[model samples]
Target: MADLFDNINDWLMQEALDENPLTSIVETFGRRLVEGGVPVARISIGRSILHPTIGLLDVQWEQDTGQVNTQAVPRQIVRNSLEIFDTPFGELSKGKTDRLFADLRDPDEVARFPMFEQLAARGMTYYAAFSRSFGRTHHLYERISNEFRGASLSFTTKRFSGFSQADLDGLERVLPAFCICLRMDIERFVAGEILETYLGKISGKQVLDGQVERGDGQEIDCAILYSDLRGSVTLSQTLDSTAYLDTVNAYFDCVATAIDEHGGEVLKFIGDGVLAIFPFDEANRPRANMCAAALSSAQEAFARAEHANRGRSGDGLPALHFGVGLHVGTVIYGNVGTARRLDFTATGPAVGLASRCEGMTRELDTPLVATGAFAEHCPRAGADLGQHRLRGFADPIALVSYPLT
Candidate 1:
């Protein structure tokens, strides 16, 4: 039995070193426990993680289905769940105990936690929870006395005989290896999430692949889409700080959501303007996909803006209007700015050209304008605007306007 447990520890360490996902690790651990003659019915691991949008990350392994399910619980939703505050897991989190065990077969003991009663109804006769820190060893005393960074592990068995002392001891012995695997995988998940959130997907992967040095870039052909809200300066002057911020966020939602849904990566929100790109493949059909996606995203943004404006009108607020510019060209997309600070963005003539097209929207009295190149590839006919001299352009720039409706 000792040899079997030691083998499991060795296997878990190897898997951790290999960086297998957390879900895969949990599923394997559950299978191993049942193989070792432990009647494991279900296992769950929960951790409060630092994330931009999620508060709790939990994984569950079910014996019947042999499935591992994972979920990200929103911060507010986790706070509102009263059952968590009443459970033994909550007690462990507050430093009340190193481990908690409940024999669900006993009504009085089950009555102490309502969740245990629910588990008993599901044929779960025994429940055990353990907590271990992922932080510094010197803070071990602080961790036991005060809540710290760690995970809470719980196991439930549906076996009629319930979990024996040996079963419980085996779990305790293997948990150190289990926590180490979880920490390694979770760190990978967190780093990926944070990078993707701060940098757009394409740029985030570039940074992760060691493209952090200043001027590290590549020239890529992409359809650039730039959208800027109209009357933002006036709105900012009229509304209070809170109301103005709400208006800005509402406007951003209309544009950003459309771009995101249509497979464009929003690179930055520059004041009231949003910069996004849909990269073109170098294959035979390059422009069709990128240009079409950009056009669809622009149409969706206009429609969403109309809906948002109607809502604002109902609230007696001014209607919001925005202009979109679409252009397809090659640009150097990579890290820029000083050594202390870096910005991942596209730079070149096309970037400036797209911004110029957006500026033309107000002058032409249209919501969307595309460069001649974008219009040619979009497959949709647009009203051609004759060549006109644009700021900083030596020659006249010809463009096409897309209908707002």
Candidate 2:
């Protein structure tokens, strides 16, 4: 039995080195425990994860078909779930007990936890659980770190012989190693998620791929998009701080969601405006695709603004208005800034042209405007607005305005 445990430890360390997902590690460890002369029919592992999208994760393994199932739960859902406060798993997590063991054959013991009753119905004869630490802390688990964050594991057996003391001891001795391996996987996942959430996908990938130098970047041709909320300064004065912020969020959400849905990455939110891009690869993609995507995104933003305006008007608030600008050209899409703080974004004439087009929206009374470079690729009808001098341009800029649909 000790030799079997030694092999399991070696295999677990290798899994950690390979950087396996936490769910995969938990599933494989449970399967090995059952095969290592332990009468285990079911196993469950739960831990608090530091993630941008989720608060808790639980993994369950079943011996019947040798399958594993994993679940990620939001913090609100976990707090509202009654099982978190009543089940033996809950008790163990709370430190009320370091371990829990119950004979499912006993009706009184089965009544102690709702989960025990279910296990008994599933033909489980014995159940045991233990709590271990992941050696880390998270904000979501701050108040409940003693009851969560570490780790909680449970095992059940349906066999008449049930789990022996040695079986329990073996699992307890190996719990620390298992926790360490799982933490390695989680740390990698968290870093990736945080980077992707804060930085645009392409930039995030480049950084992770070792493009970390201060000036690391490349020039690329792409369609640039700029959206700005009209009359934002006036709105800020008319509404309270909370209402003003909510109004700004509503406008930005419309533009950002549209950009993301159409394969554009929003590089940054410049106050009430958004800067986004759709890269064009002439070798594989047609120029028309980038222009069309930008137009489609503009249309979506208009639709969402209309929807949001109706809601605001119903609540006695002012209606929202915004403008969109699209232009196509090459730009340096890479990191640039101070030595201490760098920003990964695009900077070139195309970016400036998009912003200039957006500025013309209010003057020309058009919600959507595109420069000649962008308009040439868009097949839709547009009213040609004659060349007009814009800020920072040496020559007059030709543009077209799309009618609101």
Candidate 3:
């Protein structure tokens, strides 16, 4: 066992030295976990050990795509744990997921994990959920096998048994090395891959992968703003579809570029409309003084676009015009919907009100309008645009105009 572990360690060292140490750490140690005294069914890998029902490594056995061994694993059990730590207990993972976790030293919780028994129905015998906390977040690790298949007594015979105390002990013994390997992998992945992915997404490289907030399922005070091209409809009608698409895409580029530069996350793109958030994070609240930054960013974006459309003399290119609305309120900011389909959108009247406020920009002949909540913190911005009665709102709201200096 020492020799085998040494080989795996060396493989990890080589990966750490040569390629991405992060991927190698997960790959090397993840394999050892699955092969440990069980007829493993499926395996999954997560970044850290403080896993709240997430997979660190995953493999499934299939019968038809045709095979003798079959494994059934819950899809949500541990796949997208990248953002689970903040997903409040009982919201995503149950309050007590396992016996070996923060605040769960009780022996009864050892059986609280439903996967152990569920996996047994299909001949699975035993399973385990392991975790470790790294940095400010937690990571999870899981391994399970069928009674008949898990034992795998012979090369030809796949059998399973419930995990024995000795087996669990064995797992406990080698976990330190595994943790070290996984830590290295996580660092590499975050630095080499995740950062680049974030940069690309923020810059709208793979436009489909937009921003989603990974936060607790609770209402948080935030400033939600939306923008849409004013003359998009006429442009699409006058120009061919391909040309219109090109023009709209270029418009998207302008909006995203500004959002990224200003530290805002582009939530989603709706046709020619862009939804985004500024200074979003836990513990951060909407402040009128800081609101200028977002508005300034938006103004700079329009200036750039208008500057670009100057030389397109006869292209029938739509005038680079957009209306922006801002509203500050307690909006639900986290991954919402379901495991299969989730949207990172701000819920509550604040977002819709912001949209409605933006719509007013077209009607009011102004480029920007902010809700009273948005202006609540601005330093002497009341003198600029002043107050107005917002439609659908009972009380009158005070706000400042766009293009903050």
Candidate 1, lDDT over the whole model = 0.85
What is the clash tally of candidate 2?
0
Q: Point out where model 1 deviates above 4 Å.
A: 135-148, 282-286
Candidate 1 residue-wise lDDT, 106-208, digit = tens: 9998999888888899989999989887753323222223455678899999988788898888788888888998889778888888888878777788888
Using lDDT as the yardstick, the better of models 1 and 3 is 1
The residue-level lDDT of candidate 2 at 395 comes to 95
Ordering by lDDT: 1, 2, 3
Per-residue lDDT of model 3, residues 379-405, tens digit only:
535334556666777876666565533
Strongest candidate by lDDT? 1
Compared with the true structure, what per-residue lDDT tens digits does model 2 show for residues 5-84?
77887788888888787767766777777767787899888777767557677888898888889888887766667767
Question: By the lDDT metric, which is better: model 1 or model 2?
Answer: 1
Q: Each model's C-alpha lDDT?
A: 0.85, 0.82, 0.53
Top TM-score: which candidate number? 1
